[model samples]
Target: MTGGVVFDPLLPWPLIATLGLVALIGVTLALWRGLSGWALRALAAIALLGALAGPVYRVEDRKPLSDIVVMVEDASASQNLSDRPAQMQAAAEALAAEIEARPHTELRRVTVPDGAGDEGTRLLETLAEALAEEPQGRIAGIIALSDGRVHDIDRAPPLPAPLHLLLTGRESDWDRRLIVTNAPAFAIIGEPVILTLRVEDSGAVPQTANIAPLEISVDGGAAQRFEIPTGRDIDLPLTLPHGGRNVIQFTVPEAEGEITARNNTALVQINGVRDRLRVLLVSGEPHAGGRIWRNLLKSDSSVDLVHFTILRPPDKQDGVPVDELSLIAFPTRELFLEKIDDFDLIIFDRYKRRGILPASYLENVANYVRQGGAVLVAAGPDFASADSIWRSPLGAILPAEPSARVIEQPYHPALTDLGQRHPVTADLQGEENWGSWLRQIEIETTSGDVLMQGVEDRPLLILDRVEQGRVALLASDQAWLWNRGFEGGGPQLDLLRRLAHWMMKEPELEEETLWAEATGQRMRIVRRSLGDEVGAVTVTRPDGKTLDLALEQVAPGRFEALYDGPEIGLYRLQEGDQKTVIGLGPAAPREFEQTIATGEVMEPLIAPTRGGILRLEEGLPRLREVRAGRPAAGRGWIGLTPRDAYETRDVRQTPLLPAWAMLLLAAGLITGGWLREGRR
Candidate 1:
């Protein structure tokens, strides 16, 4: 209970002050006139004025409240390294016991986990939330048990008391981390791309650990090793082997005394893109469908087209002289023999062998396909004649042979069972609404998968692999009829584009592929194949643990399975002969980016609160009580300010003097003054 005297005015303060001034003036006048009862009159005026100014005594019933101490436990991934988890656990238990032992204090324990995805440790954010939920006046102090590798330090809340950090890791702990400071999202294939990276050593790094061995692997291929010095940025010049996502893994062997090898490796994914696609379009004769190939290739700004038409063959004996004719001679030697490899894809549109390209030039074309080149053949009715290019040496690389037959009936082109699953024709839109083709060349598929069929279910499209290259055969040259919207136009553009890209070895268009994509820690493993079913994929985690995941057929030839990776790092996936590597989160998660524990990040927030950082290596500091403005940490102890907070249960007020008592006293003083004056 507490008591204090307070004023409860009977009238307005200004009115009371005016009346008291008037009474004081009357008393002073009486005294100036030498009145015998001047002292008695003054006494009477004082009694009346005191009665008018109401004074009361107040008493409050008070209850003491317990002070709250917020303790944030950093259970993030970084705190799990080495013996930090044990250290943190021990400190937390000790702190909890201390709070319970205190006379009037409570503990608010908050456990901070790893942030979703690569957001890292959100210790400060968690602390802020805890502080917001608790009453500020009752909070005594804030404490965090962590490695101090918090990622969200900028979100520190306004501290109501001293904030202390009990650092979790040992002083001798060390780590080696790979940092990719500069990696482009997209890089031109075959052109050297400069990637900036640095290998860093933190904590108590050894003197002999100045140089580290760095191994680099692209697309999960064999790694190339190099000796690189630490503590400096190295510019790595790399050319991607193929287009699409190129997963390049850079690893530094874990040093002898390093805390973990997780940070020693980093994965950088760069999409490889071609500078430009060079296409050689060879037209045997000027036909209606010849412009279709030209238009399709010309539509894409990335394709560089070189078109040559045999307008007037050497056998055409028109009376026009060579000088008078506007025809430019086809550079057979430059295109087929000398610079064939310069083109990424070569298209033969209705091309039939005239005396134009000799057997030697055709043989060189076949060799070009064998030496990692791409060839696409669009056959016309002439392909069934004796003049067909199938009679040439290039037929060896072609997937189909001409059957000396032509189908003239109009028929809608349809995807075969394999084509429905093949990337080139898989799920192509508006297949049922496709227009009809008036003509198709009959052919027997000698090799490769038949992707499409024409009249009487003859092979319309065939794709094959030749040694290190690729070849595609489209039996009909009348696909331009779809372009003209006969009945209803089909996905001609999409089909041709996919077919061309597939032959050019685009990774997305491959018939057999294995890859994984990640959103946060969850991954979608995809398997694309031409076969009826694929075997289960074996997933190898960064820790070398392996698990076989069976996939469900989502599409005809596409199988997929969802996996939630336990941690962030490079994951290797393999199904049969197809193998791929993907990084789930960041190559080096934020937790492992700085495995060595330090108090530098929390120092700024701690200083203003007069709090100290105590390393667990020095042992857990004893908890003590200190005043709010004083330093809250000493050599072997940390302090929490005791907030003398209380709750008021009840309050009572009593008048110091009653109105009747004040009136009686005033009347007595006045009578005494009158009697004295009468005697005088």
Candidate 2:
């Protein structure tokens, strides 16, 4: 119960003040004239004025409220390292027990878990939500159990009571981490790109741990070791060996006293792309299909096209000078000898060995294919003639050799069994309506894949890989009929683009490859092969555990599997001779990025509230209660504020003087003073 004095004026304050001022003036005048009743008049006037003020004695019945004490628990992944989780559990239970044993104190437990994606630990955000629910005046204290590796430090809310952090982890804790500071999203194939990375040592590191052994691996191959200096940035120069998504892992061998090996490794996936597709088109004779090739090549912004058409053969020696003939001599020497290796792809559109290019030039073209260059041949009826380019040294690299026969029957093209399993022709199965080719050269496939068959099931399209380069041969020149919308057209554009890109070694068009792409926790894995029977893929997780996943055929050559990852890290996928690496959420999660714990992040917020940050490494400090504006923490103990808050259950008020009592007293005093004045 609490008691206080309150007022309830009977009349307006202005009128009551005027009446009192008039009485005071009259008493002052009487006192100045030596009136004997001046004292009595002043006493009666004082009591009357007191009655008008309506003073009341107020007594309140209040029930004391329980002071709320909040306990914030950090259950993030970082806190689980070493014995920190155990430390947090023990500290939280002990703190809860102490707060519970206290008289009229309520304990509020707020748990902060590991964040999804790369959010790490949003400790402050969770604490703020808990603090917002309670009245600030009733909060006696807030205690946090964390590793001090909070990600949202800037979001700490204004604290009302003393805030204490019982930090986990030992003073001797140390950690080594691999940091990928800068990485590019895409890099040109066969070109060296610099990746910025570093290996750092944090916490109480040893003196001899200045150098860490870094292991680097591309895809899922064997790791290569290098000694890298700790605590400094290092630029790693990498050249993508193949085109497509390349997974590069930079790791450091785990050391003693380190928190975890999760941070010792970092994964980076850089997509490999061709900077330019340089195509050289050689034409022995100009035809309608030559324009199709030119238009297709010219349509792509990344392709640089060079066209050379033999307007007049060497045999057609017209009676005109070379200059006057309005023809520029073909630079066969420059194209085949000077800078042949610089070209990415060479196209032979009905090209014949008509002495325009010497036998040496043909041999050089063959050598170019063997030395990592792509060649595509669009055969016509002339390919079956004795003047065909197949008679030259280029025949060694060609997939098919014509038998000097041309079949001139209109027939629709068809995909062979191998084509159904080849990425280049996989999507062409059961095409709605295909255009027909009127002429096709008869040829036998020798050391190449027959992707398409013509009349009598002859090899129409063949793809072959030479030494390091790739080659393709098309037996018909009537593919343009599809482009012209014959019989509602066929997939002519799609087929040509795929064949060209495949010859150029595009990773997406590889006949045999395994790779995975991820969005958040969902991963879509793919396996491409040319064989009809494909086996399951073996996936190795970041922890060296393996699982075999059976693939489902999505398309002819595409095998797919969808998996939801339970954790964030690098995943290694392998199918037959193919192997690749992929990162799910992060190569190294944000939670493990900095595993060492410290109290600097919450010091600013704790300081303003006179709170103390004590580490559990030196034994959990004892908790106590303290008054506001005083020291809230000491060497061996932490303090909570004594709120002294209460709820008023009932209230009563009684007037100090009743209206009748005030009137009788004022009249008796006035009458006694007047009679005394009259007698005098």
lDDT string for model 1 (461-532, tens) is 999999999999999888888889888988888889988998888999888899888887899999999889
Misplaced by over 4 Å in model 1 are 1-4, 8-53, 663-680
TM-score of 1: 0.92
- Please list the C-alpha lDDT of all candidates, in the order they appear: 0.90, 0.88
* Candidate with maximal TM-score: 1
**How well does candidate 2 match the true structure in TM-score terms?**
0.89
lDDT of 2 by residue, 540-579 (tens): 8877888999999888778899987778898878888888
Off by over 4 Å in 2: 1-4, 8-54, 358-364, 414-421, 427-430, 453-459, 531-533, 659-680
